[model samples]
Target: MVGNRSCRIAASAGLFVVLAGTAGCGDEPATQIAAGSGTTTTSGAHWQRLPDAPLSPRASSVMVSSGTEVLVIGGQDTAPCPPGADCAPGRITRDGAALDLTTRTWRTIAPAPRPLLGEQAVVIDGVVHVLAQNHGPDGYDKPARLLSYDVATDQWREAAAPANSIGAALTSSGAKLLAYETSHEQGLVPDRILDGGTWRDLPRDPLAPSFDRVMVAVGDERLILFAHELVTNPGADKPSIVQAAEYDLAKQTWRRLPDSEIIGGWYWSHTDGLLVDPSIGGADGGQTGNYGRVYPEGGIFDPRARQWRPLPALPAEPSDDLWQGPATGGPELAIVRGFVLDPGAGKDGRWIRLPQPVRGAAEDPAAAWVGDRLVAFGGTVHTDRKSAFTADTWMWQQ
Candidate 1:
């Protein structure tokens, strides 16, 4: 649990403080970037602790970087609720803040229009589009809403909402924003937002039904949808089946890829192909309660050849006890457990183990590639319970 130290900085004002020699801040730690025959590579990257964010301790916060500032949005905070009304233990916060990378300073931003939890934010053009979930006094069963924030103006606006209440998976293909949802009733149809407000379904062929799916953008105008369907019959041969297809935005059509042995799990897009870590729903495999495991091999998917190629196995095996704790990376590299793998660096790449944060190990924190560095912030620490929320922020740069 985080200590009760109040974040004393003024709201909506920049707090300038020299971060040198701050407690819990460390100098650049050593890193090894290696390249060889199908092995992990080492790099000279290290971690640096930024000044503490001027906000109460929280977790599950959505962090998005635009220009030189990184915005920290809605999250669940440990602060107690106001006295007179019935409320959940800890309240949801609509407050937000910004960290100026150029100046190494922190400033509070305008609070969100509404309180949201577990929402996802993506930058299209110069604005930040947040797919917000409306959890009123009743609870989180409410429909999801779309909200847009202008970083230049520090203003928020409500956009046209999706057709369904369930939130959609959001990603960008060039300047276009793609939102996909696998509904049992509506089937599989993806919506694209080109100008940032209106969303129209992409014209395509019928998609197969699946227990769950993962989508990633390939190149500037193509997307790959990986679907996994479970075998209902007890006497069936395999536990589940995995299928993939590519969508061409130019033609607005879907073409089924040749069936290959690829496991569908969390994946990050890379220059060569898609780097996949075959772990599901955190380290504890908690997503098994909803979407059962489909495939469990870490590999790469080449969109040009339409073939699946296996990469070297990850150094840290999937943990059965941690929830959503698999290694995650962006376009350039991947971090499994604490080890970093840069598959795109060719033969000069090797797996580099990251130094543990001064606070402790991060439990599935939200991270984003901001310019030349990766900024990670606010995740659970001790147990899977909500009380373990943390607000510590760390950065990794080569």
Candidate 2:
């Protein structure tokens, strides 16, 4: 989480074009590192490096596609922590920018009245709606204010705040937006329905106190929220951040799902259900440990069928670095950062390695599928909480 005071954006607004080659995400899925081995090719697609955006690079920002452009919104990065502190405090901004898909040009968008961050963003109709942190951590769990942006007018307007949504998350369901906390952080906060500009509280349901936070994804008429589950053990705390719940958006009701088959596995939502990487190792091989594993041998959940399915084994191993982007579902499903899991490609489905970017992605850039092209904007690398952000935009033209 970022501190309340907004900080200065690192760079000035300018658009510069550059072309470069060679990039690597250490120990990642065959990022074309070796002489011939890393250079594996996929047909009819290549990566085009576009002009750097008009804003300084940042991570955890929300990027959404609005047909004509890709808008990159609020993000945070920390300052260096002292020698003994557990972590450093970061800064969040209300700043935003947009890139024209056709012109490949970048322009600044109006910033929200309040800064925004979190996984609570979803595209509704053609507008992108986000929630702003209404109240700080002042011992009171206050509701977050809802804000919506229009790409056509390049304007932002405030809407009704949801039910105790401070740090709560949201996802889009058809023409409506569903907002709820990942856990019972605000003491049984009710799930919210934002249809049009009005907000309505759904019937409250009891939820676990699993609030450490993860992603919220939309699947069919339901939205699945991923949260951390703290395990109380004798020696040390071995919490798995994979517990989930499903909210039937149509019915406006909540259903607490069962414990994950592979506890602590990384999961993302597919159009059908959830995608899990049940590949974990270390002291607790294939089970819960200190979360010492990174790459996930893909698995999936079928919400309609209420079952889990395993994906084909990855062709190569990946680094300990976490997979950073959102899971994209469709004909070519992208779970891992640079690879697309095409379920119908082969007998068991195969990984299609994307062309490597000169400035590597998957380290927290806002990614979106724009038609046949995949656009990734502004990723950062942090050292001592000192972030080195990249303004470079990479589009995988397929």
Candidate 3:
């Protein structure tokens, strides 16, 4: 669906940029845009709404930059109409759109070759590589669903699917894209590392629980997995503590880090963005696992000390305000978290929070850093109306 509308809402004081969408009026509908450009209104600690063509509402989708353009794909829209509250956001959309980041303009692109709901993608070597499974009412199953998009050619083609059928929460570390399938059914514990057209399965950490989790690439040689069990079962004592561990690809080993050692908040889906310490020489030295900081709830992890350290404080108070509703609403507001690592050590890395929640609902969010900017996508939410998702795209500029 295509839409066109604009409004210059107040950001800080008088600084107002154009916000085009089907929202900001009436009951306010969930809308998205792939195109538009404008000047910055407020200077610091503020998000100036960039001009953009309206996008159809989608939940749990993925968006990333290819060159100067932004690609948004796969999200369900839940807008209630005459058919009760369910008519608001419409339906799930597999279509994709391109927003020119430099020009601030929008253009609809070819739809995804296949329809995907809770899927994710990463860009490497100038190619947009996507890993996903088919989402049906029953659940997801393994299929050959790997694909890649050529930004230069404006075309979509096939890539290798994951080694198994069902998986969620995808991320990239160094040269490899990592993904895992969460299952309690049988002995099926699926995890794969895809690189240069190869898939390698690493051993699961015995301490790691079989629950929903987030996977992120920290530094060059390590992968971090934050595991969480939302609800305790019948015999469990209480809600379990969310656990974090770093995996070294070179050593093919997993090192579990104590919660007190890291300085970042536990992002839903364990979706903490990883920035490498540029000061370290090559990928061999410095803090090996995760050097970047975690946000909202401040903290850090020291690879050399083999321990976790707390950070300063959150910039905003934890409450439910309209503009600050992000903090309490769907997991969307939680997206903002303090990140540590810097690609170049010459530059100092500090803990900074994202402006929004990476996940739509309380579900974990998925994230990847392309260049200096961090790209986050997808996440589930349980609301009063019904369980929903989000495909909103955001870029964290350093």
Instruction: Order the numbered candidates by TM-score, best leading.
Output: 1, 2, 3
- Regions of model 1 farther than 4 Å from truth: 1-25, 28-43, 79-89, 136-141, 165-167, 182-196, 204-206, 230-236, 239-241, 270-295, 315-327, 347-349, 362-364, 381-389
Error of 2 at 160 (Å): 3.8
Q: For residues 289-345, write the lDDT of model 3, one tens digit per residue.
A: 322332122233444455544332223322221111111101111222132232112
In order of appearance, the predictions have TM-scores of 0.75, 0.69, 0.59
Per-candidate total of colliding backbone pairs: 24, 2, 53
Off by over 4 Å in 2: 1-44, 76-91, 134-143, 195-198, 204-220, 223-260, 265-267, 271-298, 319-331, 359-364, 381-387
TM-score of structure candidate 3 = 0.59
Find the 10 residues in a row with the least total lDDT in model 3: 1-10
The local distance difference test score of each candidate is 0.58, 0.54, 0.44
In Å, residue 199's CA in model 3 sits off its true spot by 2.7
RMSD of candidate 1 to the truth, in angstroms, is: 9.9
Candidate 3 segments whose C-alpha is farther than 4 A from its true place:
1-45, 54-60, 77-90, 139-144, 182-188, 195-198, 228-239, 259-299, 302-305, 319-398
Give per-residue lDDT, candidate 2, residue 167: 55
Q: Model 2: which ten-residue window has the lowest total lDDT? A: 3-12
Per-residue CA lDDT of model 1 for 366-387, tens digit only, reads 5666644767777655523333
